[model samples]
Target chain A: MKSLIVVMALSIATLVGLVCMRVQATQSGKNQESAVSQSTISSDSNSELAQGAPANPQTSSDSGRSLVLVASLTVFVLSVFVGFEIIAKVPPTLHTPLMSGSNAISGITVVGAIIAAGYKETGIGSFFGMVAIVLAMINVVGGFLVTHRMLLMFKKR
Target chain B: MNALVPLLYLVASVLFIVGLKVMSLPRTAVRGNLLGALGMLLAILTTIFDRGVTGYLFIAIGLIAGTVIGTLMAKNVAMTAMPQMVGMLNGLGGGASVLVAFSDLLNTSDHHVDTLIAVGLSGLIGAVTFWGSLVAYAKLEEWPQFKKPHSLPSQQLINAGLVGLNCLFIAILAFSHNSAIQIACYLGIAISGSFLGVFLVNPIGGADMPVVISLMNSYSGIAGAATGFVIDNNALIIAGALVGASGIILTQIMCKAMNRSLSNVLFGVMAGGGSAGNVDEIYANVRSTSPDDIAMILDGAQRVVFVPGYGMAVAQAQHAVRELSKVLEARGAVVEYAIHPVAGRMPGHMNVLLAEADVSYDKLKEMDEINPTLDSVDVAIVIGANDVVNPSARTDPKSPIAGMPIIDVDKCRTVIVIKRSLSPGFAGIPNPLFAMPNTLMYYADGQQAVLDIVKAVKAL
Candidate 1:
């Protein structure tokens, strides 16, 4: 019941935001400002949509959502434990290259988002979902690509 | 399509875990990152239709607007302020999450006590992180100086007082679930976060932007994760966790890069300001070398390691550097790029730069991995980078960066500096590395100098 309310509220904001975005274009002259505005809209759109109707039963509860959470949590715990085991001795020797590589991972999200967002699907929700996916894609892909080039320094000897 | 959400969630989570794990290893890190990113994309798409939509108007507008702005940011923002830009994005991310939490609060009417309470908590934490990041962004770009009151009667007390009142309002949220209370909390936290943000970052010097960026990034992730709990989103939960874990790791890396503990940096607790002797005057006749002189040196070298810094980034000379590397490689001289932990304006700043020029991922080397090779690397090309390559960390006790690890570039057969001026780097300390016996200064813009060197090598 509460989840539905949250989704409904989000949908209203997204609707309002979409309308207000027309104003944003006219009001803000800067492109980044509009980009910020775009993020503003999508941030609301999904939550609103998620709460509005019967979301995939899987994402609606912790018990059902346990798979991904379990995977991430277990890894997080292991990383913490392992990281501590090697604490202060890791020497950060691999930090620069690793950062570059992870940043590249952040870049790869762009491809997925592009695929989803650029196309039109039967459901309007899916269509907008695709768009949001595209935006997310840009963030991930761009971030990772940059990272790869940075870490290239550590390749071999 | 409905089942797609869970499928993608599982996939994204696995990728995130694998990507993060693989990123821990240098050789497969890039590929791991790419896979994780693909997972995130899948999660994002799943979440999009998680909310049912009636029209495509908003979607279309968002795509167009975000694309245009992101493009401009990519094209226009100078490389020197990339950290600030990255911080700005974090602020935006946290800010949106906070606002979404607030909107959820506004929508509550029939009084689902649990939901209202969750949203309130999410809002408070998210607000702090979002607004806090905004202040960090401003400091990195507009004000690169540290600021703090030498003696404040009760700085901590005042902030605590405001936050206490904010918590009082949160109690009301449990009973009433009112938007008005939500408004008050938002205002309270906004003011408090602004103060906390200034207090946190203002005392930090410009040299620590990477840490500041990572810390802020951590805050952003926490905010998003908190919001996930409020919304009960499987995708949000997973995405937020990935971001949070990665952010925490980034902070750790950033802290290590500066050779300081995160706790020490955060509490205004520092070991030393810097090595004073590093700045002590030394008499040496400084002479500038032209592109031809550098070319001759490069041509004769058996191996070369090009160390790109913010100067190289400002020069936008990645292509020339790549071409020069190819030239050296053709002549049977091994070429590699040396990346310092904190070499550029932001974390991974140098990597992004070189990739923009299409340099392959196979030729870069980490500081630790390459430092041992300086003894054999015939020439160490020092571009616009400063502090990371500075030699004082090893010898000076009074210096701020004393005891911090730095590249052993001075150990190389010869060092060539490509810069436009003698101005000090972020640390405001003159590099003795520039005046070492085998070091030669090439006073020119990085791109022009590298291009010139490429031409000179051709002539040779």
Candidate 2:
């Protein structure tokens, strides 16, 4: 178990490092693709700060776990409303691409699948976790790639 | 490290909402997709680093295999096959949730009632979404066995029974503490739910597919949320809830467009036993016209509206349509594209196809915007569309598409329909618009017909 944990930790760290490098590469590549678009991306990300509430630190207290669970439920409820509100006024023409895009976002279950695969002790749990991870990754990767490919065609003018 | 985990998830959640918000406009949609992808990456990395996870080999293998398979499929899939692809991927998403939620339940030595309930619900919803999505894919791709609506005798009763059995199994598992019994209950819930999924989606006719697909998308999201509760992951919960709500809204929009309720869509078994023999009678009235003669009609027309449907996608005719529109515009004819809300297999399907052909966004007009002034338009050119423009939608109360809103092409001075045959749409009902006095059927492949028209118009 200890060996597995060490190997897992090392691999995760390495993967994270690789991901960061790839992100940097993409950012540079994006800049070269279009300076105007690059400016818009940076400006859009900054606006995220205007939304209220960073993570509530109280979730980490000795209630052991349910506190975090409760906090999660709260976030879940709020996000449903936000999701509806954000997309309410979308024109009919964008309904297809937008739905496909959001379907990709729901593949966020990859995070849970990864955690399940990595955190379990028994072989059965690990096997199911691996399957889950693969499926979720497929959703995430396929959903995003297809969406991006589709979006590339939606040029103005 | 602890503070960082929640903070990262929060950031991820914010990014997802922002991404979806900005995606409404074509200009920022690509960036929105990128932001969402980045958010997913952050959330996954944070979860891996949090604690207790140790199966690096499995994670690595899954990630690599998934990335390769997903990338290949996404890059290779043609735009015309996109609906089936989306349906297939949605099934994968649901399948993942089912496995994750089931495994988590299996690993649980100490049982909480709430956890059991969550697991059961997730398993039920996930299985339904998974199998339902598969059926949707088959239907869309026209798999022989699934091509027609497959319904049991008294389908509503059977579906109700399946639903009841699923709830009963969940209740038994939630109350039972015995491990063996609980496992059996879980299996029961999954099997019953899978059967329910097949039954629920099988009854829906092809015309109602957009709604079914949208609803299945919602089911997957709801299932993911239930799984999040089982695992207590904030990112999964938030993201799943967002998709769940958004999908339901999209489904409602489709239903409204079709003038049907959710129940009518799911349980109505709409296709029934309509005779196929009448198709011959219907087509006897179709009058075929050459592209040159139609071009002559367009030579003097002041306004022209192009209505495109699934046939446009099949024939890959958007570019031809765009070119033809440009020619018409240059000839001092006002040209615009009228889009029915449920025009194609998926929402905004026509827009995506047109956008790909570099059709100016403003030239595409929604149904309501164009319907009011359709009578003033000199020519309405329908490319491979059927039900969405059928006059039966407004005139015949007994028609399957009765009360559904459609592009008012019939009211236009001259209606030109470009289609291969006088075939019915998904509804298996004849379109009266094809035989109307002003309507001219240009029987040809959508692409060939449009290209020929473009050439003919150029010659004129």
Candidate 3:
């Protein structure tokens, strides 16, 4: 538990450093729009986000467990609908880029990958986790950039 | 902070939806891309804060290395090679899910039935998607000599058997308590699933590559969704579902363009159909025209349409074609480009090619829009397109491409087909449109032919 706290502290420090760099970059008029958005979102949720700490399952009741599962299922079903509706209207001319673009979005698994890799110190587990992180990051970065490059070529009248 | 995490995730999901919505149009696509990227950033930050994740050293390394490599690859890939790049990215997504599920199973002290089921699915789908996408990349790049369709005897039976074996292994892994036994079962499931993926994609002909790639992409999304269930991550689940749904819709669109069902694409090779008969017999009555003659025809024509295909992409003729169109327009001809949905190797491939050549998006008409008035078109210039414009889809129900939606370029007053030879198209089927009296085949490479036509038109 102590090691876990130390790890978290280190990560917090790193995140702070990144935020500072982002602020500097933005001041210099670099393309740091994402930094601005990130700061805005973080500031809005700064207090409550820390309150939503991980709850140990040992103390949670069975009803709580079931409720979590139910909530997740609801989210899943609703997301499926949201996905179908949004993509249904995509023009045939944009299908390939869209596929690749959303492909990058699915790389959200990198979030899972980071937890898997860093949550434990076991050799085998960490190794697999690191591999996952790398692969998912590649998908995330490459897919979006490629989609952006392709979409930029298209011109309107 | 905890309450804020879900709210942030919800915001991120909405951004993704908006991004996709805006991406449907050419005008807002770049902004849409930015929105999606912003969503990703927000989601990643939320995960970090909510989970209170540690071990920054490795995370920093992986993130930096991946960003650098992925960015370089995205920047360097030529437009023609975009499909393979997409294939690689899809495979990586699947591979990541597989690893995540494997790690989750390893770390969990108590495996609930639901979690086990989710992990099992993650492993199975991820394995298939990974291997299948690799084969797709190989086929697209023609990296290995084994590009030809290779099917085992009783292929469907074998595929079904592999699937059954994989399911049984998953069941054993989930139910068994012995760590040793569970590990063995896990390995078994992965191996069988990987082989199944290879078998599934190996026999699919190159003509169906677009559908196969899209299907694999969907599998990767399903795998990610399964991983989300295992880890109980709302953002992952939402993102995965979005990709999966969109990919399925795209795959369906590809199948419809080719007049093929998904099942037909997966197992069509079992029939072992031969390539459409000899080109010699089909091209015997075809008349050949020179650039000068085509130029002469175009000089007097008022309504002209240019139909481009994969051949134009291969010869890099889009710019030349654009120039030829400009010259025709200068000669008082109302020139337009007709794009078949499945004209190029990938979906919207031809559009990207034409757009790169500075062709105005407004002047490019879809098959449905252009086909209706084809009869009124004075000159239809077909550059390296065959099957999509083939009249076989209309006249011969027995043809392989019959029922497929093709541009009705054959109905024009004069159809000028610019190709290197009388060779068949990617489908390996001879186009009977070449034999029509109104059609004149200009035997030349696509880029060279268009340039020649431009020169000849200038002289006229």
Candidate 4:
């Protein structure tokens, strides 16, 4: 019962955070558009308008980036709920495999690492990215294979 | 093609969820794992076509090298070393997150508040998980320096200070305009977070490893999710959240089984520090029995159950126990294993060991499942297990392990305990079960005792 309360509290907190971020993104989007339009028509403040006009694209992208954040947060929270519902049903016998299997899933960071490595933006960044790729892949491959090996051993008469 | 990539990622996320769902059942678990791997492969392949990913040579090299190393580790690890293996893998995953977050922070020109915060979180949590898991792995592997729980008088204070330092670093990183200063703050967060992790996990006792490992697993997942937010990838977010939730559930289960709270385990509070009854007084009536005597008891026993613990793993007696079970079955006796949730170093540790020895999964019953039926069993053979079967948990309210859920092995008609000595369990409390009138002690190594019992039963 206490654990249930903790879970509910966590869910509520995550939802609230995501909702706030979504609202912030929408507001920022509106603000950026109004700023762009206002700067365009205010010809008397030419210097200010010139400086602000150049940053319009960047501000617009910032809002766009926030939208992406909102989307990702939505996915994260929903997947957490799905995880709770699905994982709760797993019996004790499979707990170890569940842990190792999920450990493999966390290796999804490898996707981010791959992009980082292949972007070639900075020499140090690529170096770290390549190392991250190796580490994440080890987690992916090792975690899954070990779990599979353990699962295969569970035979019934 | 670009649209198809997101669609593929969506498909991969769904596959991961479906795979975890399928893993709930034993029969479909193997297929479920394969499906997860398939999803992973799909996600990786799809990422290769991502725009701006031009350095294919490095990616190929990393993939090949990682695969070779991962496969060898997976193939060569013994079942007994599973906890260590999982810990090591968790550390690698976390370490990877730290690197990815650092790389992204360095490469991206966009210093958005949200992105910087996410980057800070990814670095902090990832570094903590990596360092903490390495400590856990070393403890499990029984490194001499870490074999015993190490604690200082100001351990918690030190840990709190580190956490404060990390948070300060993260905040500076988030609001800082200078990239160089931002990078330094990020490094500060990682370094402080690493020390925080080490300090937090260092003092925890060996018996609390299951909870610690589960918590570390959750941290790794959360770190991955933070990295996902940094990279703005839904696939990573989804997968990381699933793992995070799964680890939380497992940690909750472990804590419940031990009747301890998460905080209790984390703060290194020894379970039930209440004054236990005197050791000599508790074991005064303890009766000793030999293998022949145990065999004679088993000869006429109609129902028998074996309770195993970490000591069984130490003795490597799983195969011997299986042999004994087979012999008992041939003699028309029922044999089943009563598995306690926190029995070995990790959750489900004993079950994996028994599975490796070809024991049928059906014969393994959970603590709750077998407790009610223990009264009807003719004999309960406790092979190296102690605390789980201790009657004090139920009878002695003042005992250290009071209120903890334990197998009611003492309720059986006859109880046979195979152990080397009367030493206390990880809880360091004397067990009154050893002194019960119906309980008989068979003093020997777990494997030797089981093998002797098999030989004696055959001779009978």
Model 4 C-alpha lDDT per residue in residues B1-460, reported as the tens digit of each score: 3245556777787788879888989999998998999999999998887554777877888888889999999999999999999999999999999999898766654456887899999999999999999999999988999978888788888888888888888888887766777889989988988888888889888889999999999999999999988876667887899999999999999999888899988885685443435666668789999999999999999999999998998999999999999999999999999999999878788889889999988899999999989989999999879989988889888777788899999999999999999988888888888889899998899999999999999999
Between candidates 1 and 4, which one is better according to lDDT? 4
Highest-scoring model, DockQ: 4
B1-460 per-residue lDDT for model 3 (tens digits): 3246556866786677778878888889888888999999898777666544566666777788888888998999988887888888988999898888887766553454566778888888999999999988898888665488888999999999999998898888777655556667777877888999899999987778889888887888888888888886667777888889888988898899999899999998523223545566677799998988988899899999999988898899999999998998888999999999888777777887788788988788889988889999999999978889988778878777778999998899999999888777766677888998899999888888899999999998
TM-score of 3: 0.88
Each candidate: chain B TM-score: 0.82, 0.95, 0.96, 0.98
Clashing pairs for predicted structure model 3, backbone only: A48-B1, A49-B1, A49-B2, A50-B1, A51-B1, A52-B2
By TM-score, the better pick of 1 and 3 is 3
TM-scores of the models, in the given order? 0.69, 0.86, 0.88, 0.91
After superposition, the stretches of candidate 1 with alpha carbons farther than 4 Å from their true spots are A1-157, B1-12, B15-85, B109-117, B139-172, B175-179, B267-280, B285-293
- Candidate 2 off by > 4 Å: A1-73, B271-287
- Give each model's whole-structure lDDT: 0.57, 0.78, 0.78, 0.83
What digit string (tens of lDDT, one per residue) describes model 2 on residues A1-157? 3423433343343234333323433444522321221001232222221232121212222242343345545556666766677677678777777777788887887876776677445467667888988888888899999999888887555
- Flag regions of model 3 displaced more than 4 Å: A1-63, B270-282
C-alpha positional error of residue B372 in candidate 1 after TM-score superposition, expressed in Å: 1.8
> How many angstroms is residue B314 displaced in model 2 relative to the true structure, after the best TM-score fit?
1.8
Clash totals for all models, in order? 41, 3, 6, 0
By TM-score, is 1 or 2 better?
A: 2
